[model samples]
Target: MRARKTTMLALTAGALTAGLAAGVAAPATATTSVLVKPGKARPGQNVTLQVPECETDGFATSDAFAGSAALDGAEEVEGRAGLATIGAHTPPGTYQILAHCGDVNAVGQIVVLPGTAPSPRPTPHGAADAGFGGGAGGVNVVLLGAGGVLLAGAAVARSRRRDDVTA
Candidate 1:
């Protein structure tokens, strides 16, 4: 009985050690470089990007766009690849697509066709008529009031707790 118990404990310890070592020895898998297909595209077109070490939650960007380019399938292909849509408003130029997976970054370039048409601009409206002036001001006032109340409540609770401890 004693020998059997000892053997079981040893096996458990060995298994646990192996598990811990595996957890520590493994490195984070992240994309080292981005590979874009065709290397050139017109506006409002889709491009496939491959990130060999990326996870499903990666992002892609372009300098030509105002912000991050629209990305699809970031969580697909076991996290190694995704599809990026070229913005229609992106002007004709040579731009780099920046891909980010965790702490790793990859970059690829694409040339935009000059003949592609630009996106249309939206019509402007007055501040009040556009639901920006009065409505936004009221929301700000309500948020400020709620924040003040929370701060005041926290101060009161802290003071009461301090007084109780002193007593």
Candidate 2:
């Protein structure tokens, strides 16, 4: 009985080693993450850029994201890849970023038009009322219109004369 017990213990140990040799252990899974640099943000505004982790679709966050440094509460892309970034209200112009993995590029654009200036009320014949210049353009326009009308009338008279001759 003692020999049988020892043999059982050795068999158990050999079986465990053989199981490991046969690759029954879990495979090594590596997690790869890319570092995303936040793009240009407004002075008083906030921003966030998602940092993508390793995924089957190449490299990038599952969903586009953005945030300030230390992306704890910011948007995160996990278990995904080949996605764009997310951001809003960032400065007033084009913004660009170099993606770490060169898989997806991040970019942004903002146009900050200057605030409207209080326009002065226009007065007819006054300095502020001089729309796109002075009376020069107005006279030119009137002369052109008169010339066109005269030309059209002359054309109609000539057509009538031709008709009369034909008749």
Candidate 3:
């Protein structure tokens, strides 16, 4: 039993030493690289961006709408991973992706075509001038009030009999 134990210990040590000597050991520093998957997509389509996991690592996007590259927003990196999703909104052309790891950075590309136009806009209705919340209340209320006042004045005049006036 003692010899078996010694042999197992010796084998474990030998394996670890061999790994270190062959430079197959784990790296002390991580590889700094950024990659985009399924990077190409049509307009109004979405693509995934992979970023290095960092506390402040996030993503940005650009569009032809601005005639320049633009960034959408940044998201929190979770558990050694950072990612972003971008939609193809720029005019049909090649697009660039910029991946960031805190201060570190990477870039990716995609082709966006005028694959489809936006859905049609709904038709607009003419202004309603005969309803509430319109200027209708102002005109209607003032007219009704004036008519009532005039009616009351006529009724009072008829009710009263003026005494005969001497000229």
- The top-ranked prediction according to lDDT is 1
Can you write out model 2's per-residue Cα lDDT over 1-167, one digit (the tens) per residue? Answer: 99999999999999999989877565544433333333433333333334343223332222123432232221245533232334332334544433232233333332222232234477666345555556434456786799899999999999999999999
Clashes of each: 0, 6, 4
**Could you tell me how far off, in angstroms, the CA of residue 86 lies in candidate 2 after the best superposition?**
3.1
TM-score of each: 0.42, 0.22, 0.34
Give the residue spans of candidate 1 off by over 4 A. Answer: 1-31, 65-79, 117-167
Q: State, as a TM-score between 0 and 1, how close model 3 is to the true structure.
A: 0.34
Which candidate number maximizes TM-score?
1
Model 2 lDDT on a 0 to 1 scale: 0.44
Ranking of all candidate structures by their lDDT, best first: 1, 3, 2
Model 3, 19-73: lDDT tens digits are 8887755434333444555555555544545554433534544452222222223
Between which residue pairs do clashes occur in model 3?
61-70, 61-71, 61-72, 62-70
Better of 1 and 2 by TM-score: 1
